[model samples]
Target: MPLTPIDPRLDPGVSAALAAVAEREVDQVFFVACGGSLSIMHPAKFMLDQHSAALPSDVLNAAEFVARAPKRLTKQSLVVLCSMTGTTKETVAATKFAQSAGALTLVLTTDPASPLAEAGDHAIGFEAPYTTGVPIDAKNSNYARIYQLVLGLAKIFDGSDKLGALMDSLEALQPAIDRAHTHFAPLFADYAPRLAKKDVIYTMASGADYGAAYSFAICVLMEMQWINSHAIHANEFFHGPFEVLDENASFVLFKGLDSTRPLTERAETFLHRFGATENILVLDAAELDLSGIDAGLAGNLVPLIFFDTLWRFAYKIADLRDQEMLEARRYMKKLHDY
Candidate 1:
């Protein structure tokens, strides 16, 4: 079935937030969040790194951002933070810390009434499956909002013209994701039994797609399913991690169309040659139908597309192991004191 098309328009709040940032002499960008929120910021930082020559950016964990207290974080800095519930203690503290430094802060969350939203200089609300059980199209996701904000900043600071093409791609993202889900469904089911037997699953990827692999390993596999997992950078896989790759080991490699794709392809080549063929599952973005997106920009959006598809695979493995994805948490939110 064809998924519902997303509206191509940016949220009005995004425009206003960009306008506010444009008024400042912003010198640097810091993406601050925790867990999956931090993962989504990786591609935004990568986008700015590729397109903006003068603006420097970094993705920082919320608690670390507050603790490290970089000297560069000042009135001239733009701090962007995301928390799905807008109530993450570390994130809220980071938002207040950024504001205390007189930095321009933009917070993305699902509610206007959230404490994180109330604390930021600007806030943009997004629809997400985490907050609402109903699945929203990718266009309205926190990743889309962050990407749009980064594209806007790139345009304002570096005079880049990629936002229009990106908006167009966002409109087509849902159908592409639908097609990918359809294609990967049976493959995931077939792989689930073998995957369930593994004690630890390693996820590998490079460039912008690395964040997706990281999130799947930590958030989905470890947090949700209570599986032992680690995410490895494909570029660094050759350094020392390859020694651990035997036929009994399992891995999920993500290959995207970005400049760092060759790095992952090298890892894939070695994985096959080492006789780990049956235990390795490769998810290549090149296999997805991205005709709706501009060729130059499609690679930049691959992480968003991969997230939608890999989420289904998470459920498949969880089902095979009789684990409850949502209700199985032991210490995530149950503890009062850390």
Candidate 2:
């Protein structure tokens, strides 16, 4: 069944908030968050990097941003922070720090009343399946909201006319995700036992999709399933990591239609010829039916769609290994001190 189509319009409050930021002198944009939240910021920064001609952007880990404060982060900067629960201590602290620096802070979280939200100058709440434990309208997800924010900034600062196209693309994201689930179901089932047996798994991607690889490796495999995993950029794979290639090595490679597709494709060709690893799994964005999305915007949206698809694979591996994917964390929030 097709998912309900999302309204191809920005939320009124989100639009108003961006308008308020446009009134300010924002010379730079910083996206600050922790863990999965941080991962989501990467594609936004990448999008802005590709489109915005004037405004510089950076994605920073929340704790690192607070510790190593950038000199450019001043009153003329806009800082965006995101957290699913809004209580992530590092992100909340970063938001307060940005506010103290007199930077305009925009916060995105599922919880409107979260400390991170309150710390920011402007807050936009979004619905997430992780928070709600049910499928949500794609337009209300963090990916969509953050992409909207980036597109809004581009439209205002770079004089871009891609927002309407972006809206159309976002509307198609959920159905793409749904199709991915159905398409990958049998493959994930077949791959689960092999993945579960692996002591370490390496994820690889380049360009805009790298964040999805990183989040799946760290957040899903390492944190949730307690597996050893690392995300290696395809652009860097040939330089050093490729030496580890052998029949025993396990990898999940993400391929997207972005400009850096060749980087991953090069690595993919090498992996097949030299790695000799039957455990290699490639999740290509091209495999999904994206006919509803704009051609120019579909590549950028790959991370969001890939994240959703990879999430199901994580669950499959977890079930195969008899590991509790979510509640079995040993040292995360349960620890009093890291």
Candidate 3:
């Protein structure tokens, strides 16, 4: 069965909010949040960097952003703060900080009445039911909405209809991603038992997909399952971290269709040839049949689609290990005073 398109149901008020930002000539955009929400915005920052140079963008940790109050944030800046519950203390505080700094603020969250949402000048209530642990559906939906929203605003400002056309072509994205997950589900299920024995693992990727690598390593692998993992960029793999790689190393590599595909290829080649006892699992985006998607826009969408595959893989690993994803947290909410 095909999954429904999530973007079409976004509140109509969001369009007016985004359009208002464009009309005001927003010069800077800030993707601000904490934890997984912050990780979700990383690709959007990458997208903005690649497509819209006129709009300077940054992804900031909500607490750090509020504490360090950037001098450049002003009325012409747009801050996007997302929280699933919309009650995260730092994120809500960051929303207030951005507002105090006179920046145009938009909040994306499940609750419209939550502090973060109310603190912003405008908010888009996702209305998606939250899932336990990683919240795959919610995160993916937010990613789609954020990506489209950012591009839509850019299109309005640049007076180019390219993003609009690309979005139209992506109407079937939910199903395309679903298909990728179905294909990879069995592989992840089989790999989980072998992976559960390892005390630590290395996850690596490059380019736009680096966010996926980081999210899985930190959010799912480390936080959810209490496994020790490191996410390294392929381009930087040869740096200081290369010394840690040996025959006994365990690794998960993500390869995508972006320009940095060669970087991942090189890293994969080196690890395979040199690391004899290494347990290597490579997930190449090209393995997924993307014929249903537009060729021109495929490169941009592949990384996002690949993230869905990675999430399922991580979820399987956690389940196989008999770890309760939600109960693994010790310090996140346990020690709230920090």
In terms of lDDT, the best-performing candidate is: 1
lDDT to native, each model:
0.87, 0.86, 0.75
Against the hidden reference, what TM-scores do the models get?
0.96, 0.95, 0.88
Candidate 2 lDDT, 45-134, residue by residue in tens:
888888889899889999999999999999999999999999999999998899899999999988888897788888898998888899
Distance from true position, residue 114, model 3, in Å? 1.6
Residue-by-residue lDDT tens digits, candidate 3, 195-312 = 8777888889987778778877888789888889978999799987878778778888888887678999999998897674337888888888776566655666776677767766
User: Superposing all C-alpha atoms, what RMSD in Å does each candidate have to the true structure?
Assistant: 4.6, 4.3, 4.7
Sorted on lDDT, best first, the list reads 1, 2, 3
Off-target runs (Cα >4 Å) in candidate 2 are 1-8
> For candidate 1, which ten residues in a row score worst on lDDT?
1-10
Clashes of each: 0, 0, 0
Cα lDDT of candidate 3 equals: 0.75
lDDT of 3 at 48: 72
Q: How accurate is candidate 2 locally (lDDT)?
A: 0.86
